[model samples]
Structures are given as structure tokens and as C-alpha cells.
Target chain A: MEVDRTDGRTPNQLRPLACSRRILHRAHGSASWSQGDTKVLVAVYGPKAGTKKNENPEKACIEVVWKPKTGQIGKPEREFEMILKRTLQSICVLTVNPNTTTSVIVQVVHDDGALLPCAINAACAALVDAGIPMKHLAVAIFCCLAESGYVILDPTKLEEQKMKAFVYLVFPNSILSVLPEVSSTMKGEPMEHGIITSVTHGAMSENDYFLCLERGRAASAKLSDFLRRSLQSKVPGDSSKAG
Target chain B: MLMEAKPSTSPATFVDKIVVPGDVVLDLSTFTNETIKLGGGLRQDRDAISVMKAGKLKFSKPNKYWVESSQRRYVPCMEETVLGIVVDCKADNFLVDIKGPAIAFLPVLAFEGGTRRNIPKFEVGALVYVRVVKANPGMNPELSCTDAYGKAGEFGLLKDGYMFETSTGLSRMLLSSPTCPLLEELGKQLSFEIAVGLNGRVWVNADSPSTVVVVSNAIMNSESLSGVQQKIMVEKLLQRIK
Candidate 1:
């Protein structure tokens, strides 16, 4: 019972990934990330002045604004913004810049599949570019479950529509540290194995969800490595040397 | 894996190397007899000295270490000299934008040998070279127009100069000792007065506007170029200008 993908790829294959940083000169930090045809551009501004109303003035506040490919922002955009903001807040060192607000604006450049995951990755790169104090970087990936209990690593837009369920997962990038045995763990899993954020669509069995998570976690390692290498290569002084 | 492999335990080996956040640059177990000073973009967690941002790890002789990163925005730090524009004049302070998180407060009495009767009159949007006296969290930074010795020195109103903004990394490069290649090359031929602020603002004054434009543009473009590249770039610009 094999499911054929229109692109004629294996069930575990993902589309090519492309990322570029500092595309917008005016924004404090900006990045554009594309996974196949899906593209998202994110700009980070501030830690400026004060926080919004109802936010504690003692801690830095994160605000997110999501812009769709066309038209005004609606319910789905709002939900995306909230999820992005919370995911970002968990990674940043907020107390370092108290009584301030850091705004992350995500602009949808294109929609194919795994758009949210692409945006999250773009946002993470932009934050790093901005020199915002963060504990670590997060890598995001998307996985879908097929009818035959097969899990696909990354699905195209058409495949997404045909899938029974899909999930977006964010995980912390694994670290290669100098200190021995500093690896943190949650329960029995290593720290990087812990999920930072997860979003699901449609109903799926518990086993299917766990299977998606397992596949997604595996894919995130490769994504995070790519993210790390791309960022390191573009570092100001290093790039000139490499070139 | 080889690209990200940091030096094993010696902090000295990490000096002048690129480091990312969460990378432990210093393992204090070996430094039990030494006291190393920590600067921006680095923090001590337990016995490990960890980086707080992605940047080149810089080390100064005797005991100083910090992370150097180029960025568009400026974060306020104590005792950093910067160029600021007066945004508003208040009773005891002048609100200035130093390209930081909040508007910095320049005390009205911060000038050299100033008093209530002789407070210098400054119009809105006037540029001033000042030093940050206080940069505390949860509050606007405080700036002073005089040095720590209460002397004006080079801190005062910057008059009749064309000011532009660049990245903080570029400004730092311009202010580094032994001089930067781009500035050194430009100065060999053109006579100009330049003020570099750590906040990424650059003010250039020359005999003519064309000279100012050439010098400023050269400095801006030199950010990503190596020393040899900067020298070559400057030579080409000078030839074109001539």
C-alpha cells in the first residue's frame, strides 16, 4: 500500500531550503526563508522603549504581526501571530531588556506548504541577526500523516490538502559545547529533543501524532544544522575570508 | 561538525574566533588562579563562560574578553561615546536619540563649566557628541557632554557637518586603533573632520560636500571588505572622484 507523491519523491524527502539574512536595510534585523515554493520574510524591530498596556513593565514583551500574502490579517493570521510570539518569547532572554517591546513582523511572500514552519525559521534567523539576547536558536519543521499510517517529512500544498492530518513542530537546535556532560534533558529525552512549540490540524490517533513527532524531530536536526551553517558562513568577517 | 568545533577548554584559543549563543567559550575549571573580566554578549553561568550573541570573540591583554558583533541597532552601555541628535528640550534635560532602545537624557548642566544663567542654548535636532554616564535597565540612559574629568574635551555641539548612519560594527571599525585602511587611505589625500559614534552614527565635515559624500560612502561600503580590499576600494573611489 504505497502512496505516490506527485513530485515523485520518497515519503521522507523535503523540498530544497533557501535562506538569506539582512535583506531589509531599514529593519533592525530581517531574513527571507523559502522551503520549495513557500516563502516567508520576517523583520525584527526594537526592544524599544516600553511595553504595551497590561504587560508587565518589569519584563520585556514580545509582539508579533503577521501579514498574509494578500488582503488584511484575519483569524488565522492572528493565531499565527500569537503562536510565533510565544515561541519567540520562550527562546529570548527577556529580562536583559526589561520595560521594552520587541516586535517580530512576518510577511508571507508565498504559500506552498509548511508556510508556518518556514516563517518560524525565518523569524529565528532574523532574531539572531538583530543581536537580540537569546538563550538558543529554534528550528521548525512540518510533517503530515497519510491514510496508510505513513508519515511524510515535508508535504507540498496539494499533498497537504489530501493528508488526513499535519503538524508543525519547533525544537531547539542541538549544541556542540566545550563543557562535558552539560546536556540537559527533559524526563528521559535530551533537552534539544524537547518540543518548543507544536500545532496540529484535523484529528489523528495518538500513535499517529507520536509518529509525526518522531519524524519531525528527526527532520529538525538536519534543518537546524543547515540553519547553523548558513548563519556561520555569512558572519561579517568570516564571509570575506571565505570569498 | 568540524566547522562548529570550538576549542576544547582554553579561553585563549577561542579569542578572535567566531562564537554563537550557547557556546561555552571559557571553562573556569582551568582558570581557578585567574580573574577574567566579562564584557557585553558574554555571561558567566556557573563555571562556564557562555556567549549571549553570535559574534567574534575578542580578548584584551591581562584579563578582558568580550563578543564583537556587527548590527544595525545599538544597545546602550556605560561610558560609550556616541553622537546624538536633540529630539526635545526640557527644563533640566535634552531628549536625544542615540539610535538606542529609548531616548537618552542629556542633562542641561552636562556641558563644560556650565550654570543656570549660562546654559547653552541648543535648537531642536542639533547633533552633540556625548558620553553615556548611566545605562541602567528599565530606565532611559543618561548622557553627558563632558568627559569624566568634567572637561568638554571633544564632546560638544557638532556644527556644520553632514551626518549619516552606518552599522555599529562599521563605526567600531573606524574608531579602532592604528586606524582602519579605508579611513587611512581617505585621509592621505582628503582633509576632513570625522566623528564616529558607537551608536552607528557618523558625522563628516570636509572643505566641500562632494568630499563628504565620497568619504561617507567609502566608509559605509568598507564594512564587509577586508583590509586589503578596503585599500583597493578606496584607491578606486579616489580615482573616480578625481
Candidate 2:
């Protein structure tokens, strides 16, 4: 087995995580989350009155503004914003804040391999901090298919560049442990884990994609555990109790 | 939907209930000649008064209804005093970013007893305490440095203070009647000068910078806390500082 992973971890291991909520005093809700060396700060504003231009009066609207680590916003940041907006819009209970706009401003402090997933996690944490109602919490993990067909979970930026294909997968908080038969949701049966959004950066076969999905979903339990513990700690007087 | 006659909502009951857009707040037909005025966060749709935003529904005495919420962006409203930072200085107006959607305009001659030769020169990035004079839709909000009697009235440049931004709700809480318990407690223990603007900007100054930091941190930590919680929190903070 070729041990090429930097920061010295197994293929499925995640980096050390530290996230703090309400870091920005001015924002309605804010959080700074870092996975390994990759860090992102997210500030959520609004749940206020009215939307920006092309206003939608029916359901709540979400706008994501992504600012890169350096340089002005360009096409890549715009694409990230679109992807994040869609993922957050799915999890957030929009009908709760109708005709209002909640803007999530994400500033990239550092970009390792899993930048998007970290941004999504930070945004979700910020939304929760803002007291926004969400159907379920979402967590993202980046999976890479190495040249040797080994799937690496939560790859760093350097690891991603060395990969054959990279897949970014997001999954809503779900019950762990789906049976092997149920794991392959070929019959449209409601599986324990549902993919909220999936984006592949390089070419990979359908089998490889599904393999990456399986590995990514299994590794998500650790991320979910981190989120639950962090959120519980933030809520005062609700000190970590059995859930 | 047919406009069936429904009982008007009690203003007292709706004072603090969170409301969403399109929620029919009051059925005007049942009011029966009793005049009621709608405030911000509400709009008239046909015979029913509906909410236009998501916030706690607020109602004042003598028939006034509005929604109250703490948001990052400040919607310009007439007569509200705000602290603004000058973004640019033009011949006629100074562009100020009051954390509003549109940049507010502070006219050069809007100061008290102003004349052509006496126009106050404010450098870019200067912080000024001003009142919203005009907030027409599709136009920039106009700001002034004078009160109703054309006096400066404690509205002017704030200097040598640590200015920090908070949510509009937190700032409102700091300025509420009877004073916020946190501010009251801080004032009792420490001698410091503080200014809270409706635009959510706060300036704190003291003989020592440490006091300013402690006061600002105490206030920021008290945003989601209750009155009693704020007092307890401030006590703990003060204890740590000592």
C-alpha cells in the first residue's frame, strides 16, 4: 500500500476540527470553522423584511456571497455561491421566513482540498446560530479516487490534486447503520442517508462514484458527531446530555 | 379567497408574537370606524392587514402596529438617530454607510445654524451621529445633524472611542426604556461613556481602553440573553476583569 496521504492519516480519517459560533458581533449569526488547515468564516444576515431585486414573495430566499482568500470575486466564487445557495436552500425551512432574504457571506481563510464541504458545514452552523429553522443539518465530505483505486475521504488540497477523480458529497444528518441490501438504494427505497448534493471534479466510472459515495457516507458519522457535540455545547444550560 | 368578516386582532396580544409575511394580522372590516395605523413590517392587502416580514409583531398604544427584529441591514426610517461612517465627500452631500441597503446622504449644510462659510468639513471615514430626514423608496436616505428645533441636540461627530457594530436588536435593547439591565449594571460599576445608534453601531469610550473592551464584550455577549441573564453575565465578566 502506497502511503501518500499528507498530515499523516489513514485514507478514511478526518482532520482535526475546530468551529466557533457567533464570532462576528455584527452579523445576525456567524461562525468560523476550520478542518485541518482549511478555514472559512461565515456570517448570516437577515430573516428581515423583503428580498433583493427579482424578489420572490412566496417562500424565503437565500443568497450566498463567497469571497475567496485573496483577489476579487470571479467566476469560481460565483459558482461556489450558486452551489452553496442550493444546498442551504434545501435544508433550511424557507416557509418560516417568507418574503425575506437570508444572506450567508462566506470568506475563505484557507483552502485545503475540502473547501466547499467546509463552507457548507460553516454555513449550516451559522444558519443554526442565526436561529433559522432547518429540516435537518447537513455535512459535506470530499472523497477522492486515487490512481490505485483507493478511495480517500476528506482529502487535503494536495491530495486532491494527486487524485484520479474527486467527488464532493453532502449528506443530511441521518440515522447511522443502513443494512447492506438497503445501502444500495436501487429500488427507490428510502435509505437512511440521502445525498443532498454531489459534484464530481474529474471523470470517474459510475461504480467508482457509488463506491466513493458509500465510503463518504460511512465517514460522515464522525462529522455528524462533531456537529452535534459542537452545537450542544454552544447552547447554554444545555451542557452535553445524552441524546 | 372570500373576505369573510373576522374579528380584529388584539394589538396587545400581538405585541411580541413573531410574524411572517402574508400572515393576515388584522381584519379591518371588524374595526368599525376605530382608526388604527399600521407601522413597518405590515402592509394593507385588500380588506385584511398582512405582515410583510418575519419578526415579532409589535404594537404601541393608541393603535400602532409594527414588527420588531434585530437584523444586520438597517432600513432607513424617518427620525431614527444613526451613527454613520463617511464613505465619500461630495460638494453637496457626504455618502455615509449606515449599514443600510442604500448609502445614506448627509448634506453639507444640514448642520445646526449652518451657512455657506460654516459648512462642517468631515473627512472620509469620520463617524457622525445623524438623523434620517428622508427615506423615500428608490432614493437615497437623507440625513441631518440637527433635531426638530434645528439644534445639534447631541448629534455630531464621535471621537476617540472604540466603535463596534452589533445587531439592530441588541442596540435597541441597549436603548430601551428603563435601560437594559446589562448597561445599567455596567454603568453602576464603571464610569464610561457609551453611545448606541439605531443603526446598530455603538461607540464606547473611557479613560482606559480596558474598560471599553470589557463593556463592549459584555454588551456583545448579552445579545441573546434575558435581563436577569445579562446581569449575571455582566457580573461574571466584571469579576474576571478585576
Candidate 3:
């Protein structure tokens, strides 16, 4: 049975978000991000000289630690940690801080929905505040497939529990100029081509996935705009320079 | 004890310009006959002086060059006075958080004319103004409350002020030149006591609590403002209080 979402936002609408950078006094880079009821604070440290023996010397290692608000980190939080690291790895220009570790600590303030996306957004802002070089900024969105095969973007945690499956799609802030909008299923749509990482939960058909990707890409422009504005305020003089 | 700097091959055009890592700031081939001193954020490679960090290239006349940027972590430098919080204490050293990569060790005996019988007590969380005595890589920084002649000289416990944090760049700006315009403008209207730490902590005290609040807010807001903008901001803040 299909039911209306409690918030009354359209299925394609994302929760409203607010972000602030450099919040922590001691951390090299920090940001507090909130989307609707879910809030996450991320602190990025290092590019300073510390690395373990097995790490590669030519590139910086990205470490993500997730802390729940009340209890020890359980398995779900651990999975989110790995997902965030992999997503961030694709965009961060790790070669700039060779032989060092950039640790990103994500603390969950509240979780109503789209926790991982909020965490990813916060981490990206914190990394920028820390001045880590990056190829592009990545934004994440959680979309769910209802029982009727209708897909919804930015579902709340409660909605997630009732949905059959969900997909986490991460899109880069800008599509590479190299891959303009050529019409091909495998490689073209600017939105589809710019995806850095995609994680699927439950069974999603190819059509459902593409539909979700379309919604996510459209939603991502808003997130990217918000991030760029906040970033401009933090580091004046250059808006295009991400390094 | 270094001598005067040698002439440059060709004048470097990077002063006050933002530079990124790997950007060459100077061509050693031009100034091969003269000695140039490279400071932090700059590395001397064969025939090239390159930036090691992203920041504005800051060149001090005659020969020193470094990069300046707003940073949260403090890399300890000798003789730089900073504000620190007491985190822990041992018989000989008190661990202080100077917002550095590691905790600094403030020797209990390094205070003004100190002896074992009269050890000053700094309970955990007490704030102190101290100078960096030693800052070697791979070693914990060392701090002292006394100057070269062993006098406190404004380096001691800071009390009864509202302590807030700003970027290290803003804190440095607050201590720079004839005076920061923001501070200058505020002084004309009200009286306040301020101790700025290079590590980004600022303690402000005034005759009334409202004055402290106004001054701190104005300073924080002035971080990204120009001198003229800062003056306007201070005026607006002062007007609100009036």
C-alpha cells in the first residue's frame, strides 16, 4: 500500500539543509551540517605528517570514523564509514598530501533521514575548510523504491524502514567537461557520467536505477549551490579555485 | 645569528600573491651568486624555490619568505606567545593544549622566580599566557611564563575574561602593525582589556559584561572584512550599544 510521506514534501524534493564551516576551534577543518531533522558535524584533521607502515607514500590516505550520538558505533555505522571513505576517495586529490593521513570524524547529532548523505556533505565541507585539494566535491542522496515500484528521493529513516529498497547515489558537483551530453546508455548523460560512487540496497531494476539517478542529479544541483555559496564566504577572493 | 641576505637573481613577483604547492616562487638560476633565505611554506630545490603549502606568499624585506594562511592548528615557533589551557599536570610539567599537533609541556619551575616550595597551581582548565621556549619537530613543545631575564612580562595566568576563539590568521592580524583598525575604533568608544593568543584564543575583559560581548562580536565579524569594512562594523556595533 502506498502512503503519503509525513512531511508532505514531494517524492522528488530533498529536505532543507543548512551548513556552517570552521566551527571547531582546535580541528584543522570543521563543519556542522543539517538536513531537516538529521544533523552531522564533521571535523577533518591532518595532511600533517602521520601515516601507518602499510599506507602508500605517494598519496594521502583518507580515514572516516563515524560516531553515533548516544552509543558505541554498531555495524551500520561501520558500513557507513567504509561507504563515505570510498565516496570521498574518488574526489579528493590525495596526491597533494603524500605520506600523510587525513582523518575525518563524523559525529551524528540527530538522524531522522538520509544520515549517510548528510555525513558525506559535512565531510566534504570540513575537507574544504581543512584545505585539502580535491578534483571535485561529491554530494550523496538516498532514494527509496516503494512497493508499487515508485522511487522516492531523500526518504526519511522511518520511510526507509517501510520501503522495499533504497539506493545511495553520489554525484560530483560538476560533470567533467570531457563528457558532455552524448546520447548513450553506458556513458553519456551528464548526470549519469558524473557519478563517483553508487550503492544499492535491495533489488533495483535498470529503469528504476536510472530514474533514481535522474532525481538525484536534479536534487544535487541545489546541494552544490548551497555548498559553493558557503565556501565562497569561508575563503574569499576565489570561488573557482578548489585547491 | 644569520648575516644579511644576498641579492636575488631577479625580483620575485609572488609577494602578497596566493600560491599553491609546487608553484615555483623563485628561479635560483637567476640569483645563483646570492644567498636567499627560505622560511616556512617554501622549499629550495635545485634551481627553483617552490611553495610547499597553499597560502599568500609573504616576503619580509631584505630576504625572508614564507606563506601565510588562516589555520586552526598551531605549529609551534620559538618565542611566540600563546594562550593555552591546562589539560594535565605532572610533578615537573603541566600538559597544555596550545592547539598544536601535540600538547605542550610547561615546566612548573619555569615560572617567574620559581622554586620547588612555591609551585603555582593551575587547576585543569585554567588559562595561561606563555611563551614557546622549545619547538623541535618530533618533540613536545616547551612553554614558560618568564622572559629572557626571567620576568613574567605579561606572560602569566589570564583571569576574569570572556575567552573565545578565532582563526590563527585573525589573531595574528589583531596583534599586527600600528594597530588593527577594529581595535583602534573600539578603543575610542569604550575601554577593554584583551590578550590575544597566536593559537587563536582571545580573552576580552571590559568594565561591563556588555562591552566585552560587543568587542568580541565585532572582532569575530571583522575576520573577513577589510580595514574600512572593519571600521564600519565597529561603528555599527558601538552604535547598537549606545
Candidate 4:
């Protein structure tokens, strides 16, 4: 089956993105994001001591809370918590800030189709707002292979349910150094792994698998650009400041 | 270090009106050879005079033009009382919803120095008076509910006043009249406070009897203050020579 992808968007096209940091007051760091009609607000608290005995350790711990549209929590929220914790841990340099905890609270004030990936982006923005150090940003993207042979990038809710399989990818970007300048730092080699973390759910054909990766990579690049721009705008004096 | 220069553009447009990734329509007849400045509205493309793509715009409006755009920051100043509800409590601090991007925290220590036990005794949902102490860009704002006269003691609570939603611009315009004698006539001082949060929540408490009457009339009429109407109403309210 063929899908009509209108709006002149490529199979891996991302919606127009707008992000503003320090959007909320009480939290240590906060950001508000909008992609098309999907809007999400994320607040980051802590680096403070964790109250959970078991979870508290010498290293910083990450906590994710998802508040849905109905203003209630459910299975989806639980799953998001797990996914976010795992994804954030991969990029967060927790060892650097021991005994501190980073809490990421995501509120989906509005929903369109691609919420999970949007939430992930918002979370990353919040993390930056919170001033937490990270090896790299864990950018995410959603892709699906429709029943008909079309590969969809950043699939909306309706498109997701109609697809045969879905994939979520969280990756990082880093500058590779040509040589090891210090004994502590690893030198040379493809230095920048910029490894892509992908999770595929449901069954799909081999062709769909390759297509999903291809679309995922393209979407990731677009999101990375947006993340960079958002961070740049919030920095102390990059000229975006209002005099 | 290489610094990126901001492009020289004319000011005749509002930032919100500029469409992203879209073209703009310009009228060259009104355009001059010299660089024109655009504030918060539209601009014309010089080349074609007839059409121009939207130009790069600033995110927030400058303070000179207090137009209540979504991107403006909320700041509190002296003598301007604010109305806010306590949303959360943390030891000596109370998180009050002042209708901004972040809840403004009121420290119990800012209150009048007293020996009252149970120091920071403020309950959730309790409305209180607060004055903006300092609004630091990189730090959470500091607020005090007490002023020289007293601890905002009872002046902050709203007993018989009406509550309604309005924009920040309208609220600012209403409060611009510092000494509204009309408000004092009804046996109440024009010593009311209001908070216009960025999140669209408006909290107001008017102590002036005439001011209360004006507020009631505005609410009953479902009238929003803007342009001429707002100016006229504010002028009339400040005309009381008592």
C-alpha cells in the first residue's frame, strides 16, 4: 500500500520545531517545546540528594515522570518513565556528579501524533536547562513501515497504530579528537561514535528494518540541529538576550 | 573572536506577525531608501516592493513596548501589589502562582520580623499579597509580602471583590493610574494589588470602594481594557479629587 505524504515533506521530514528554555519558575531548569500541534512542557529538578534509599548512590540518578493529557498517570506513563530513565542514563555523565539526582518531569499539555519522540526532545531540552552535564544529547525519532510499502518518519498516533512496526532511536553527537591530548582521554580512532540507540517494537520485514534505520538517521540529524539552536538561544550572552 | 552581526532592518512590524518559512508582502510606495525600523509588525521587501519573505524576528518584545505578547517576562516592582494563590510550600518558602512561566517563591523571612510561632504558616489555596523584591535574570525572583506600612497584613486578601481573567497588557494599563481617588471614595484606598501571570491567570483585589465598583462594572460588561476604552476608564477612575 502506498501512503500519500503531503505537505511536501520527505519520508524523514520533521515538523517545524520551536523551543524556549527556562519556561517555568519553581524548577531548577525548564523548557517549553512545540512541534507542529504537539506541545510539551518539561521541568528538571535536582542534582539534589535522592530520597529513595535503594536508588541513592555515589552517582547521580535520573528520574522521569510523564503527565498525560487526561492529567492522570497510567501504563503509558510507567513505560515512558522506564524508557526515559534508560535513555537518559546512556548520555548522562552521572559519575561526574556523584550523590546528585536529576528529575525530569514531562507534561503533555497538548497532543498531536508523535508524542513520545516529542517528549524525549523536550526532556533533553529540560536537562540542558537544568545544567546537567551530558556526554551528548539523546535525540529521539519515531519511524514506522505501513502495511502498504511506505516508510513513515515521525509517525503520528493514527499512523503509528496503522503501521506494522515502530522504532525509537536515541543517539549522541560529539567532536572527535585526532589524538589523545591527555593520558586520561582516549586518543585517535573514529573518536566520535555518535552511537545511535534504537529500539524496534512489533514485527516487520527486512526491507522495513533498513528503511526505518534510514529514516531514523535523517530525523535524528534534523532534531540535533533543533537541539543545538535551542541550547544556543538560552546561553547567557549569545546575542539572543533582550537588552 | 568573530562575532555575528545582526542584519540592519526597518522597524514597522510586530514579531508575531512574521510568518516563519513564508513570504511577506511589502508596499514600496511607503518605503524610503534609508533603512527603516520595524518594531512588532510587518515589513515590505525592498527589491520587489510588492512581496517579501518574512524576516528574522526577536523572540520577546522589548520592554519599551509593553504589548503583553506571550514572549515577555514578568517582573514585579515597588508599590505595585500583586494577587497570587499559594500553590506549594517548602519549609520557609511558599510557591505562589503569580501567573508567570514560573511560580514566584515568597520567603517567610521577608515578612515582618515577629515572634509568632509556626513562622511560615500559609496554607495551599490561600490568596496573599506580595511585592516584587528583585527579578534577577539568572536566578529565581525574590518576593516580600510586607512593605513599610505593614506585612501586607490583611490588604492582600480578597473578600468581596470579583475575580476574572484578563490579559497582562490590560491589567498593566489599569494599574498605571497610581492614585485613583475614585477607588478611595467608596471608603477604600486605591491600595489594591493584582498579579498578571504569563500563563493567563489573573488575580485581582481592589480595596477602593469606587474602584471595586469599576471592576464590577468591567466584569459585568465582559469588557476588556484596550486602546481608547482602557484609557478612558482609567482616567475616569483617577479623577476623584478627595
Please say which candidate is ahead in lDDT: 1 or 4.
Answer: 1
Q: How displaced is residue A64 in candidate 2, in Å?
A: 5.7
Writing each residue's lDDT as its tens digit, candidate 2 over B1-242 gives 23342212243444576544334566575468888887766666456665544467787888888866555667778999999999998989899988765688999899998887987888889999899999865467899999989999899899888999887788999999998899999999999998889988999999999999999999878877989999999899888988
Docking class for candidate 3:
incorrect
Measured by lDDT, the strongest candidate is: 1
lDDT of 4: 0.56
iRMS values for every prediction: 1.4, 12.6, 8.5, 16.3
Off by over 4 Å in 3: A1-27, A30-43, A46-62, A66-101, A105-128, A131-243, B1-11
Residue pairs in collision within model 1: none
Q: Summarize candidate 1's per-residue lDDT along B72-94 as a digit string, tens digits.
A: 99999999999999999999999
Could you tell which candidate, 1 or 4, scores higher by DockQ? Answer: 1
Clashing pairs in 3: B9-B30, B9-B31
Q: Please list the residue runs of candidate 1 whose C-alpha ends up more than 4 Å from where it truly belongs after superposition.
A: A182-188, A235-243, B1-9
- What tens digits encode model 4's per-residue C-alpha lDDT throughout B66-106? 11222122333334556677898897788886654346778
* B157-211: candidate 3 lDDT, tens digit per residue: 9888899888878999999998999999999989999999998889999989989
- The Cα local distance difference test for each model comes to 0.86, 0.78, 0.78, 0.56
lDDT of 1 by residue, A1-243 (tens): 476999887877778887888888799998888888898999999869899999989989999999899998899889888889899999888889999998999999999988888999999988988999988889999989877778997788998888888888999887656555643344667667888999998888999999888888888888877777767764432311110
Residue-wise lDDT of candidate 2 within A1-243, one digit each (tens)?
Answer: 556676779888888887887778668788888888889999998765567788676677898899999999998788889999999988776664566778899999999878999999899878866656565678899899998888888888888888988988998764221123343243674432688999897789999999998988887877877775676452322323222
Docking class of 4: incorrect
Candidate 4 lDDT score at position B159: 45
